[model samples]
Target: MLKIEGLSKTFGKGTLNEKKIFSNFNFNVDNGDFITIIGSNGAGKSSLFNAIFGTFLPDEGRIYLDNKDITYVPSHVRAKDIGYLFQDPRVGTAPNMTIEENLFLAAGEGGWFSIGQKKKSNEFKEKLSLLNMNLENNLKKPVGLLSGGQRQALTLLMATYSKPKLLLLDEHTAALDPETAKKVLDLTNKVVKEEHLTCLMITHSMESALSHGNRIIMMNDGQIIYDAKGKEKEEQTVQGLLNLFKTKEGNLMASDRMLLEV
Candidate 1:
């Protein structure tokens, strides 16, 4: 349901600090297609999401969602159909607000997820209980008091409160503990399957990239070097992906591949 064509971007152009982040990077996702993106730092993975979300304008490119020209739609309007979860959970919520208040914002003012129409009562509490988290007992508590895992879980719920057409997860589990990260990842898989949400997640975990999404895109030097799906992807290994990256660029760094928690 989303399409990116010839998306390109650069930082510090026209000077010694000039760097080209994207060079005709193109990608697309069908409805209900959970695509996982993998690449090293500065692979233009996050930049691609920003361009698609309208947070940054591509120097020259176009993005379309379900055939509509969203290249210049601006972030607020784009938020109606897209959800973004950054590496930091704090980026998604108002830390000073109580859990209840934060969720109220997620329910939105008049948007699809808005809770303004309903009195903030037992109903919201009931929904929070479904998370199987004790959050239901602490609606009045400031979110800052919660652990990183709890915050990230709540953030995931808030992101999907309105059921956006596309979900962008930028290293959402990178900051959590191994156990917590697995928990969040499990919740993520559940949410995507249950909602049939079209998602694009950038992860350093090779196992996660292969095992979770229906398709995987491997990017290098701003271009998609590898793309595979279903049965083809089931045969992949972390070392295999590393070898491919090395074969293309002749080396792989310790920073590129994730350590298997097992």
Candidate 2:
């Protein structure tokens, strides 16, 4: 469903601070695939998502979604086809907007007149009720008033409300407390499974990577070092992944946060 070919990206190209992220990277994601990606800092995971989402175009290569080339598409235009959830709950939401208003915008239906329509509003409540966050009754409250976990849950609902062709989750639960993070993760899995979303998630926790998703990929220096799926992914353990990286990608340092999580 998604393909990247000959992708290359560099920051401050040809300057003293020039840094290369991706280099001739090529990968394919099948329809209905849920991929969990794990790597240390500066591994190009976020850059890959940005390149696909058109936050910035890759210096080389083409990105195709459902066989349509979207490499040069503007981010706002791509936003319709691709849903992205950032690590920061505040990033994707309008802090001052009421929850109802935010959902109205995310639904992308009629104008302001449609906001309070009973039919659409009921649908919103049904969706919100699934989060079990007591948000359904507080639709008029500003999103800024919600907790971190609640805001992230709302963002997840917004991102998937349209059932976009692809979803990119960038360490979306990393900011929440452990209990809250797990709750959000459970909610995320529910949304992705129910929607049958083709998703790629970047995570620092090895346990989460192994437990979630149909497939797992290990990335380093903009390269995919390992890819596992099905029985292989199920058989893997968190420590095993760490050992593999240590033995196979010698001298590469996983972030302290990653190590601690394991």
Candidate 3:
């Protein structure tokens, strides 16, 4: 479970370029809750994740995971409980490293000195097999040589290998072609379900936001403008969400990427 209380963040504060991103933003995520987040550009979606991950300190507020405050915790410390997948496949992986090697580092976060101590273990192979991407057979292959879809699939496996308390997916499938994106999304859904992981995924597709998670949230300006769950969320459609956004923001939705993708 996670709770964000009265969170606030600003950029270029106390200067001519001062811009507030979050003004007393508040949100709570329940245990094993899979939440998909959607918002226009500058909706504070990335800022929210950055604040939660300790990429930067929030101006004011507290973030609690399973009742422990982690607002100011160092990113590396938080990495133990949080697994993040970036939009760019190249970001989360060591390109020069073999697929199995990258996973070894992920499984042993603080054991970097033991990097060369082990090769691909049966357990690692077993996990890769679940992806159905045939990566298990190429464990020794360099990650950089794989296709974007393949690399992203490997990154997802590495990120979830330890079953962290929370998984942050920052449009992890956005970079792939439509077919590859669908495959990656399917793999993501499978992994999340099998692990029963609490997840927060930011997506640019209304169809993706509505189709994947049990809960859907819409962000606007600096705060959560709409939150839907259970049957409410199940009943939602892409058109309905777009209409809701227009109603709440009193302006046309601005993200051309989202519109075109949907």
Q: Please identify which of the two predictions, 1 or 2, would achieve the higher lDDT against the true structure.
A: 2
Tell me the TM-score of each prediction against the true structure.
Answer: 0.92, 0.96, 0.94
Model 3 residue 77 lDDT score? 98
Candidate 1, residue 215: the lDDT equals: 94
Span of ten consecutive residues with least summed lDDT in model 3? 111-120
lDDT of each: 0.85, 0.91, 0.88
Ranking by lDDT: 2, 3, 1
lDDT of 2 by residue, 1-262 (tens): 9999999999999999999999999999999999999988888899989999998888999999999999888999999999999999998889999998899999986675754578888889999999999999999999999999999999999999999999999999999999999999999888899999999999889999998999999988899999999999999998788787888767546353564482
Tens-place lDDT per residue, model 3, 124-192, is 788888888888899889999999999999999888988999999998998999999999999999999
Counted clashes in each candidate structure = 2, 0, 0
Off by over 4 Å in 1: 110-120, 257-262
All models, RMSD in angstroms: 2.6, 1.4, 2.2
TM-score of 2: 0.96
Candidate 2 displacement at residue 64 in angstroms: 0.5
lDDT, candidate 1, equals 0.85
- The best candidate by TM-score is 2
